[model samples]
Structures are given as C-alpha cells and as structure tokens.
Target: MAKKNVLIIGAGGVAQVVAHKVAQSAAEFGALHIANRTQSKADAIIQTLRDKGHRMPFASHALDAMDPAAVEALIRQLDAGIVINVGTAFINMTVLEGCIRAGAAYIDTAIHEDPARICETPPWYGNYEWKRRDDVAKAGITAILGAGFDPGVVNAYARLAEDEYFDKIDSIDIVDINAGSHGRWFATNFDPEINFREFTGTVYSWQGGEWRENRMFEVGREWDLPVVGKQKAYLSGHDEVHSLSARYPDADVRFWMGFGDHYINVFTVLQKLGLLSEQPVRTAEGLEVVPLKVVKAVLPDPASLAPDYTGKTCIGDLVKGSLDGKPGEVFIYNVADHKQAFEEVGSQGISYTAGVPPVAAAILVARGTWDVKKMANVEDLPARPFLELLGRMGLPTRVIDATGDHPI
Candidate 1:
C-alpha cells in the first residue's frame, strides 16, 4: 500500500504532539504538510521534525483555515490524502468543508464550538458537524469526529467493553484526571478560551436514555485512579457523550473532569466578574470586547506550561455492564507523564493525551483499517485497532478488572 499524504492544519501544543507522532510514524504517511495562521509556527514544527531526524519530506505553509475556499485550495495544491483538523474547535466545520470540497479525508478532536457561543444545548454535534454528514457521505469522503483522548480513546474503551468485555452495557463514566502541575499560578491545559468556555456552560450528560443538564461543578465525585489516586472530578459536558448516546442509546454516558479548589476559586471569581461570558459587551471607552476573549488574552497559553510541567494525567473510561449476564465493571485507561511527553514531543501531558490517538487514527486510515466511506465519530470506527495502535505509540491502555490491573 502507498503511504497517504497528510496535512495538519494547527500549530498549537496538541498540533505539535500530532506533528511529532506523525513524523515518528512517517512510514504510514507519504509527504507531510503543515499549515497554520502563523507560517513561522508551522516552519518551527517542520524544523523540529528535521532536528529529530524523522526520515520524511515535510512542507509548511500559511493558512487561514476559517476560509473554506482557501483551505480547499491548499489541500488541492498539496494533494493531501488526509486532512487532520487539529486546530481550534471553532475552525472545525470550515476545515471539514474544505476537506469535502477538496476530496480529502477529514478528522478533528472536539465538536465545533462557535466563538460567539460558549456551550450550546445538548447533542452539540447535531448543531454543526452532523449537519454535514449527508454532504460528506454524498461526496464519498470520510470525516472522523472527536478523535482525541477522552472523546477519542475513552469512546473507544466504551465500545471495546461492548465488543469484548460486556454483553449488556450499562454506564460509562469517562474520567479525566490531570494531576500534573505546570508550575503556573493558573493556566489551562489547552487553549484557554476553549478551556474556560467548556466549563462555563450548562453541563450536559446522557443518562437513562435522556439528556440531563446541570451547572458546572454541581456533580462532583472523588476518583482513585492508578497514579493520580483520589481526585475530585465533576460531571461536565463533553463531545463524546453526544455521539456515544447516538450509538449506545440505552447506556448512560457521563464525563467528569478533575479540578482543584484553587482552579475552581479562580474560575468562580472570573465568572462572577463577567469575565467568562461569551457575549461581547462594550466598555465605557467604546471598546467592544467578549468577556471570554478578554480573559483568554490575559491567561497563560497552554503550550507555555510544557517546560515546567510536572506529574501525570490519568484519563480513562469506567465502563459497567454485564459480561456473563451478571454485573461487571472495568476501567480502561492510560497514565502519561508530563516530563516524558515534553522530552519526547515538546508538549505537556494534556496535549500528549489529546494528541497521540488521532495520529494512530491517521495511521489506521492510511493502513486502510479505518477508512469508512462516510462521516462518523470515533465510536463509528473499530475501537480495538485504534487502542492497540495507541499502545505502541507511548500511550498504553490498562484495564482494571475484578482481579487486578492489567494491560488491555
């Protein structure tokens, strides 16, 4: 099989991780091209690839992914076989449209988030990405959604339980615990604007075959993970629940994120001060500003946290159901160290966690193991292959069975 040409559209921390992973696994893909709003960032990523001695031909270009026509032109110019949209969540649909128009396979980490709106109602994918499903199918191009760690691998874990471990699936508690300390007073793991916007809206979950929404941090629980141990993670709205519910209608899909009190206090103060609102309000001096954007401008960039980042992050899916027609529960997860991730890929723990899996998906796509002829979510693909590929790519999955912890 010929290697597929791949083009990555973002140069952020997660995009850095993806670039390193892709460069390391260059055998799966042909020529590599990276495009970003800042061409220097893309060039720097390519430089890193060269410094690492990755045996691959690489190119970099300037791109405004917001312009679908521009992205389409770039894809056509590069003759890219696959378009990995690892950029901001806001640019998802536009990039996906470019992929469709250019006749290239498209994939992204999270569901689309309108820069104008923090968090919309439940089944968020239905609003933007899902609307293009028919178009993608008709165009005969594949679009994979939520191929990141939590939504990507965690979603796969749930499906794995359904395939190998469970007979009747019951509940899925997707827990993401980042015990890493970036040595910063306060900073998000990824884009600050996207990070704050995620928690500010109503937390949505699929429970008992219905949609349930709540205030952020309203439902909290302590989780004793493998390395992170006992940490408090609150039920929060996530991209996986929306797609997971569509696949496993009877199962309860919930997402919980670990956060410290210090972070909560800071978030609370910011929210109360109207610094977290997505709506733009004019200042007395006639400056129009979105509260969230203003706050994001002041906060530290998630990528900067890499060098001083310490500790590990444990993210997994706690799946409960029937295996032998009796109750059974298993936690399938991976623990990644910040230092190790930095040493290997020049990225932090969170970026490593969210970034690695999609490269595996890209490899699978190139290998013809995951190229479905339509738009789909992570669960829509075969979960085992993706998980197995991730095991070889620095992030290994372990399962907690009744007996003890073991490899998946």
Candidate 2:
C-alpha cells in the first residue's frame, strides 16, 4: 500500500496526543498536517514536535470543520489519506462527510452529538453516522467510529472476549475510572460542555436484549479494579454500548464511569439551577446565551489542567461468559499515568488514553491491517492486531482472568 498522508482535525488535548504519536510514527506516513479553528493552536502543536526533534514534514491549517465543503476542500488540499478527528463530538458527521467526499479514511473518538439536542434516540450512530454507511461503502474508504479508549479500546476488549475467551457471552461491563487530579477545584477531563452534555441526558444501557434507561448516577456499584483499586462507578450511557450491543445482542452491554461525591454535588447543583441547559435564553441585558456554553466558558479549559495533573486512570472491559462449557470471566484493561503522559506528550492521562488509540488505528489503516474500506465501529474489526499495536504504542493492555493478572 502507498503511504497515506495524515490530516488531524482539532488541536485540543486529545489532538495534541494524536499529533505527538503520529510524529513518533512518522516513518509510516508520507506527511503530517494539523488543522483547527485556531491555526495558532495547531501551529503550537507543530512547534512542540520540533522541540521534541520530530523532523517529519508537518504544517498547520485553519479549518472550520462544521462546513462540509470547507472540510472537503482542506482534505483534498492536503491530500490527507487518513483524517484523525479529535474535535468536539458535534462535528463528527460533517467531518465524515468531508472524508467521504475527499475519499479519506475517517476516525473519531466519540459519537456525533447535535448542538441543539442533548440525547437523541438509542443507537446514537443511527441518528447521524450509520446513515452514511452506503456512502462510505460506495466511496471505498474506511471510516472507524469511536476509536478512543472507552469506546475504542473497550469495544476491542469485547471483541477479544468473543474471539478468544468466550463460547457464549453473557455480559460486557465497561468501567472507566480516573483517579487523577488536575488540582483544580472543578474541571472536566475533556471539553466541559461535552462532558456536562453527556450526563445531563437520560442514561441508557443494553441489558436483557433491550435498551434500559435510568437517570444519571441513579445506579452505582463498587468495582475492585486492578490499578485504580476500589472505585465507585455509576452506570452511564456511552458510545460503545450502542455498537457492541448490535454485535452481541444476547449479552448485556453497559458503561460505568467513576465520579466522586464532590463532582456529584456540583453537577447536581448545576443541573438543578439549569446552568447545564443547552438551549439559549435571553439574559436581562437582552443577550441570548446558552447556559451550558457560559458555564464552559467560565470553567478552566480541559487542556490547561495537564501541567498539574497527577495520578492514573484504569479503564477496561469486564467480560463474563461461558468458555469451554464453563462460566468464566476476564478483565482486559490499560492503566495510564498523567504525569508520565505529560512527560511524553504534554497531555494528561485522559487525553493520552483517548488520543493514543486513534493514531494506532491510523497506523493500522496505513499498514492495511484495518483498512476495511467501509464504515465500522472499533469492535466490528479484528481485535488482536489493534490491541497488540496499542500495546506496542505505549498504552499496553493487561488481562486479569482465573489464572491471575498479567500483560496481554
């Protein structure tokens, strides 16, 4: 296969990690390009590459990814064969369309979310991405959805269980625990608006072959995880569940995320006060503003917290099923340290974990390992090669089974 030039959209925390990792693996690709609404941010990332002595041919561009025509034009201009979108979730569809038009492989971390709507119907991909399945297929370009850690790695974990460990799968419980602290009074790991938008809506999980709904934080369980130890994780709606359920309809699929009491208290107060509302309201000064955007503007940017960040994150899939006619369980996980991530990539663990996998996916695409030339969730592809590549790319995988815990 010919070397594919890479174009990365968005210059946020996750995008930073993606740029760094792509630079580290620059030999596999023809050239590297980074684009964002703020060209300066993208340029800063390129400067960081220079500071780290990565001499791969790289340039930055200003892009408004919401405009499909502009996105297409940029992709064509850069001749980007693989477009890594680490932008806000709202731009997924537009970026995917651009890739389709430009015939570039697409990859993103999260599902596409509407700016006006909080939570749409279940199987979120159907609302936006999956609708373009025929387009991607006809275009003959790969589009890998939800390639980040939770949705990305966790999806692969489920596939790994089905492939190697399970005869009849029963359940897939994805737990995400961030024991890291950015030393802030309160701030989200990623975008504050996207972070708040996630929980403010109904929490949906797949159980008993049906979609189950519950309020956020209404269901909580203590998980004795490997590195993070005992952490309380609440049942949460996530991207992987939607795709994973379609693949393993007979098995229960759920996502749980750890949150401290302080976070709960503050989120509750914000929700009750309507500060998390996405809808615009006219202020007393006759200025219409979205409450959620205002709160996000007031909060510290998620990227700035990396400098003071400390601790680690444990995120994985705990799969339960019958293997060899006997019930068995396995937990496939990865632990990332914030300080270590900062030392290497100038980002925190959350950004590092979310950022690294997509580059791995890009490498797989460049090497023809995951270039299926169609739309797919991470689980829809082969699991071993992706997981093994991730292991070699800094975010190593670990397994805990009846035999005891060890590296994958």
**lDDT values of the candidates?**
0.91, 0.94
C-alpha TM-score for every candidate: 0.98, 0.99
lDDT of 2 by residue, 138-255 (tens): 9999999999998899999999999999989999999999998999999999999999999999999999999999999999999998877999999999888989989999999999
Q: Poorest 10 consecutive residues of model 1 by lDDT?
A: 114-123
lDDT of 2 at 245: 89
- Candidate 2 residue 177 Cα shift, in angstroms, is 0.2
* Candidate 1 colliding pairs, count: 0
Residue-wise lDDT of candidate 1 within 337-385, one digit each (tens)?
9999999998998999889988999998888788897988988778888
RMSD of each candidate relative to the true structure = 1.1, 0.8
Model 2 segments beyond 4 Å from truth?
Answer: none
Off by over 4 Å in 1: none
Question: With candidate 1 superimposed using the best TM-score fit, by how many Å does residue 330's alpha carbon deviate from the native?
Answer: 0.7
